[model samples]
Target: MLYLICSVCLFSQSTGGIGIRATESRGAVISPVTAAEPKPELSSDRAILSPRDEYSSGGNAKADRGTVGHILHFSDVHLNISTSRNDSESAAIPTVYGKDAPITLLVSALAYAKKVLPKPDMFLFTGDSVVRGNMTEEYLAEVVEKNVKTMAKYYATSDSNKMKDVTTVVGNADTNPGYRMNLTDPTTEENPQIALIAGTWQDSLSKADLDLFKRRGYLAYALDDTLTVLTLNTLPYSPSHEPNTSDVLDPFGQFAWLNASLAALQSAGQSCFIVGHIPPVISSFGGSPMWNETYIRTYKKIVGQYSGIIKAQLFGHVHSIEFRLPLSCSLGAQFQRAGVLGDDAIEDKADLVPLFMTGAISPIFSSNPAFMVWDYDVTTHDLLDFTVHGGNISSTSGTVDWQPLFKASQEYGVSTLKASEIVNFVKRAETDAKLLEEYYFNSKAQSRLQSDCQDATCQAEWLCSLYWFSTVRDYDACVAFTTASKSNTTTSTTSTIQ
Candidate 1:
């Protein structure tokens, strides 16, 4: 009812009757402009800076009883520095994805976030602060220090008395795990490197979280009395079982910890916001997801059980601006349907939550470097709206100025930050000529300048790859369908965080 009222007053131009989905928080319904549809795909899954009590104007004044809160979210900065050693492995592979982002690009992006978003309550960096390469501890140290230093300049105050309003989780690349490295022609070493990250990031984490993060590569801290930020290490090497041994990549261990953590938060009457690098959904682009099915199902069940307290999920491994809906079935139900909780499992539809994947600062894969800023309700911490800031780059010209591409509430004509509205927008863009063109060019770095999209077919294939948030399977399906429908029609078309 509140959303409908706000939608009419704010988005007066919208047509037809509105459909609303009520959040667990009473009187808070995310208004969906479109009707609810059965979502067949599986769902997927921050920091305390400034204590919760200090949320009101940095504790300068009592936060208006129900004032709105704002925060900035960015990810996949893949900051790659070059080594002078020409013969070294890191030197040989000059880029990951396409080209590693130069430090200047990252600087510009952060400057832009600071300028536009102003003083956000907190800054959330999903993961992958460093690019993968020949990573000796010394080299890794340099990488971590540079990133942390730069981030501190923006997120932290000069005095350093207060903990910075920053939260970072570990990415697969950050740890330089064995499976991620190339052995035959090794670029980075095949070893666990959590210590390098933890030690380097020590000052950024909360005092209580420092030891836990150093030991487990995951940590949780309260942002305020009402909200707790849970940061998880979704990397392959984040040992799955307790005692966290070297042998298994047990998502069970991660889930067990998460379950306990959520219970604690719920008991405290605090809501949760989870941050991680990998998403739980099956990918067709890369091989399989980082986590096993058992882990995913159990994770989803826990999220569902505490859905009342969980606010949002943030991720960035894919380096695209995308979202995954919440889980539909219980872990047991999904396990029963799929037989084994592996890739074969089917994800149920319903009880959808929002999983947002922020775009990368790296110009890899021709994606436009971009970032997002969100407006949220301080009382409920509900994401009210978001805007994508993107920049163009040229191999010859470097990066252009950053600008806002679109705002969700204004452009999409919806009030609430619901998964359905975003999904429907992406689905509609498939046929909406103007929107499809915009989506394709902005999906990757320097896409606007690239000549790869030779024709309509190329455009279609690429759009399909990006369609529905671009999991590996989604990409394969897009290519297949584009190829099959190649002769159908004719059309062609075509930022920076780093």
Candidate 2:
């Protein structure tokens, strides 16, 4: 278990460190461009501090900038179980494939998280918690209840064995078209989660069935004027054109209920943490024009419609952290977005410049499965800070340590942390893709060379040795090495609401 300590020392209330650290926010720092503008009151604008406050993790010289709410979020847990009929045969099990194993890694991640921070106010588990979103057929009461109990029981923490008054949301992989059956249909059956609001079954549960889940009882264990947690369920496969699918799937009736709930809290000056499966839009995964944009537009329509009350949207489907604060009309968390960066199948591809988007819990990901612990500041009532502990998630932590994950990544597939290596590999392939194979020939006879040359993998490596020898610069070889990498081959497909 890779334990993490997200230790926070609130030495001085005023000088919370986030501001100074955010010097990079505006890109390079400059002298008091002008006297800093007076801090705006909550009435004038939304809290400047983000949830899981990044701006609060101050390095700022100035103290007591203002009050803020903090949040610690986890998303995209594609947790898998040995439910596949294919798994009935031991030969089909993954241990023999020489590929990365999932069971041990996930256990390690869980153990790591539990070993760390004592507790967090609320734990948010976004969709895809159940791999394939098809744990057991709804008709099989024993199977359905067992699956729900196992899941809730599997990742639970706290004396209550609850992850948090955890606000859970549904993800695409959680349910699909064929998998869905009408909530009221005679064939439909339901198994209650210990207590959490998620689409009864991703797509399988229509909006009404989901609404029924909400109405059956409080989705949140504790709900009152003091706190309001909204668990919204938006399916992953809704078509691009319909923004109001909620009316059919689950009526925005829940949304209206949320609006009223938020109003009551707002009127009382109480704060709220609204969690959901999907974050609005940075762009859909592939930058599909319609995919993310529709969601963004729909999110705006609903949030804007309730702008008077709702505070922020918390979510975890992307499996990556995103601290997005819409400059126009902020919709989500004050902290933008955040996720623990390293986990199986997915590496926290981070640009340290703005790190929130890099962290998220990874279960059934890259090779490590982990979760986070958030310390909520009771004094300020803000999610102050969080620490991510890798679950029995060592690329080898269970049997080995981090090294095995890296080694396995190379043998089975590249680890996410090896982005630079991936870039290089792709670029090398791009030359071939571009039909520039003439650049190198593997013919042993034509390329015969001295032993040292033979020791080099390719002409490119030998060229490097020549440069080190200063015998010849081989400028073209050197220049190609640098220039080929300069051009970015990857495209941004994510949608931006702008």
Candidate 3:
């Protein structure tokens, strides 16, 4: 039954878009405007601001006085070293649709990021260093080392040539067999896979962090006196993960450690960003859960307990731009697992942490390669805004042109990337045709690879995904309600016209 439902959902996503017309031609670049240039009016609902207007606002004047910090985030490079070596001649350009990224593409992306934000406060790479495939353990280690060194080299400080502070999580593909990790007692013995990856990251991590990561494939890096980044090894929680031990309740003792760490952070009055490879939510691409229900429930409970100190949850693996709000299921609604609920079941917004899924640098999913530069309040550790820069891979010319795709603040018209603001945007998109269409276009980083969605079921899936529905029954209810509402709206409009 689950397999059948997943098959149908996958089909819907593959054919889904918001039926928004493409304004720019394939590979067309929009020039950045200067401060002197007159700002364009928001005449059309589909219209978005130029890169200059989007970012040049400089946020709050007080923040401009140097209280703002920037973090450069990259994810899922998925470098295919085999293809890169075999096709050295064409390695200067980005890889085409079906293949993972080549060495050239990775270098190009890092170089572009360096050029744009040379001195970001911190660097974040949330997983998958190598492409997914069968390979010898030695060869996999070599690939991982190369990917790590490449990033370190690019972000090295100009003054001392030291590698910048980089926080990374272990993706499923980082191991020999994807989504498989050995469950060993960290104190008594070390996991060979985690040890190998830790060796490559030695330069970027502290001695304590390296030791901890070597043992269990997770670490907490203190970014500042008030801010820390907790990078998790989420493989054991994944549904696709291969079971290696009988202790399913707490794989590698990650949850207990997580709860303790968060509690410590809370006691110290410091905030943190929870970074992980696979998120603990329903996969928006397919109507399936990313982690097992047990892990998800445990994770949610821990996060909710420490919600006051968790700034945001950042994840990769989705390979697309999207976010998940706190699950707002009421007490009775949570237990009632079989059917859709009435409108009152939708609870009011709460101050739960918001999860931001970063897009991939690999175009393997037919998504344009992209990365993000995040702005935040230095004192409060609040996420202010983020700008996504995308590289358009041209099929005919076989080259990638990098440009700023959109800034979250300007595109969504939100003051900050808060959960409440994002929730409001989701509500607005439900009825605003132009806003919904614009969001659908940006969701894929403006790639034309997937066709526009014309089906109502597909459209509902896209919108409800933002809410992070934990159960299929809840997700289905949201979809059914949305589809019917749209139908009624259309009918009412038509009758008025007559």
**How does each model score on lDDT?**
0.53, 0.32, 0.67
Q: How many Å off is the CA of 238 in candidate 2?
A: 3.4
Give residue 447's error in model 1 in angstroms: 3.6
Candidate with best TM-score: 3
In candidate 3, list every pair of residues with a backbone clash.
Answer: 17-453
Candidates 1 and 3: which is better by TM-score?
3
- The segments of candidate 3 whose C-alpha lies over 4 angstroms from its true place after superposition are 1-66, 83-94, 156-164, 244-247, 327-350, 491-498
Cα lDDT of model 1 by residue, 1-498, tens digit: 000001001111211111212112211111113333332221110111222323222112323434556667777777777664232443334322377676777778888766665566667877777766767666665776677667767876335433325445767666544224211111222123555666666665545455555555566655666777777767643323223334443422455566666666666677778888877654424434435544454455456556556788877777666555432133223223433233432332214366666778787766778887666666787765666777677455475467766555545444557654554565555455566555544445334654544455665564444322213443344354454444455432210000
Question: Candidate 3 lDDT, tens digit per residue, 128-230?
Answer: 9888788887767777887878888877433563223554588988998888787877766678878877778776665766777788887776676778778
Kindly provide the TM-score of model 1 when superposed on the true structure, using C-alpha atoms.
0.67
Clashes of each: 18, 59, 1
List candidate 2 stretches off by more than 4 Å: 1-74, 84-103, 133-163, 176-211, 214-225, 240-252, 289-295, 301-312, 328-368, 383-386, 391-498
Q: After superposition, how far is residue 26 of candidate 2 from its true place, in Å?
A: 46
What are the runs in model 1 whose C-alpha is more than 4 Å off?
A: 1-66, 84-97, 157-164, 177-192, 237-252, 284-290, 326-350, 394-397, 423-440, 449-498
Candidate 1 global CA lDDT score = 0.53
Candidate of highest lDDT: 3
Give me the displacement of residue 214 in model 2, in angstroms: 7.1
